[model samples]
Target: MTEDLTFNSKMAAVYEKNTRISIPTYNSLFAMIQSYYRVQLGEKAASLLLIGAGGGNELSAWGPSNPGWTFTGVDPSEEMLKIAKHKVVELGLESRVSLIQGTTDDLPKTHLKFDAASCILVLHFIDDVQEKLKLLGSIKDKLKSGAPFILVSAYGNHDESELQARLNVWKSFWIDAGRESSEVDEMVRSAITRLSLLPEKQIEELLAESGFMKITRFYSTGLFAGWICHTE
Candidate 1:
């Protein structure tokens, strides 16, 4: 989690592979999100903020289908954004997609309100409760009221028994999914010790305090969940 928001060359190269091995239903979850946005936005020419848009996955998934929609993909990792940029170019979406190498706070304050936003698998890296709220608040500030925001991250009850049970199952899933034992052990250790996973209820409370409402969980597997929230 120390480098979850930013990635080195080696980590970036293996991210797609390792993520598939570790996170169950990784591609399917993205597909569901794409469907949700497309159905919700219709033919409207909307702008989207892809907070922590690493590897350009969101742009690649959402752009070609919604040709009218534009995206501002922000991330702290230059290496990750490099791939996203190349993907945008390859998809010939350079005209509609803007890539920025910075955190959400570094985004230019614009009168242009986003029609929707997504912060996926990003915020848990910031363990500080206040910082997490601040980050969500920043994203909320950019969105128009009633705009849907998709947020997905690892979260769980912190009880020792619950965490241990889930951790063991998660570790086995990774190992069974072809990850080597050493790598699985290391990842499980990091998840247990380094990652800050607040309970689901606490996460929802923070979101509500950050000005999101009608939070709906659409996907969940292992301790990870995805939600569609509205700024109200």
Candidate 2:
């Protein structure tokens, strides 16, 4: 197996391209996330904490239109962070974006709380449920009361036939996008091996346990799901 999930330099170089290929509605997902924030926060100056900011997609998509928004992004992958930094520079958002090369735990102890946060295309990478809770708890701890938060993740029980059927459709999406069948097969295998897919109900449980409320499933495509909620 190639272990393509690892965000090394090689993978980082092609991350955005591959991601778009894998998720047909990739761009729209970010747009929806921003839309949720816009509806909640309005045109006021607000700070955002982006978990898994290595891809820079959130920074690039949300920065220009919301000039009043400032972002602090944290990711554990150095190579991926390099790509995100380049994107921030390219977008000329140096003043509004801060990229940190570490996890939320590495963030300095501070009393500052953000107005919003996003965890897009993340979470599934952790196979452990406890770790997932920890990440969600950390994000909750960083937000002000009733702050909006968005989470997009791969979900569904891998052992079930319904999810397998969805996986088949997901594979065809890649193949239709021009990826070689064998390559797509391996990618799917890698995903099944590495991703920690849970049933939708379990994901909601995690959100509620982490002090989030009004959890609503706002988006779904193939194996991926998105939810919007507010910190409690």
Best candidate, TM-score-wise?
Answer: 2
Candidate 1 has an lDDT of 0.83
Residue range 1-232, candidate 2, lDDT tens digits:
2343333435555887778877889889988888889989998899999999997888889998899999999999887787787777768999999888888898778739999999987899887999999999999999999999999999999789989898888888889988899998898787565799889999999999999999999999888999999997
Clashing pairs in 1: none
Alpha carbon lDDT at 104, candidate 2 = 88
lDDT of 1 by residue, 111-193 (tens): 48899999988978887999999999999999988999999988886665876777777788887877788987887676656
TM-score of 2: 0.93
Model 2 misplaced regions, further than 4 Å: 1-13
Model 2 C-alpha lDDT versus the unseen true structure: 0.88
For all predictions, the C-alpha RMSD in Å is 4.5, 4.4
- By TM-score, how accurate is candidate 1? 0.89
Which run of 10 residues does model 2 get worst, by summed lDDT? 1-10
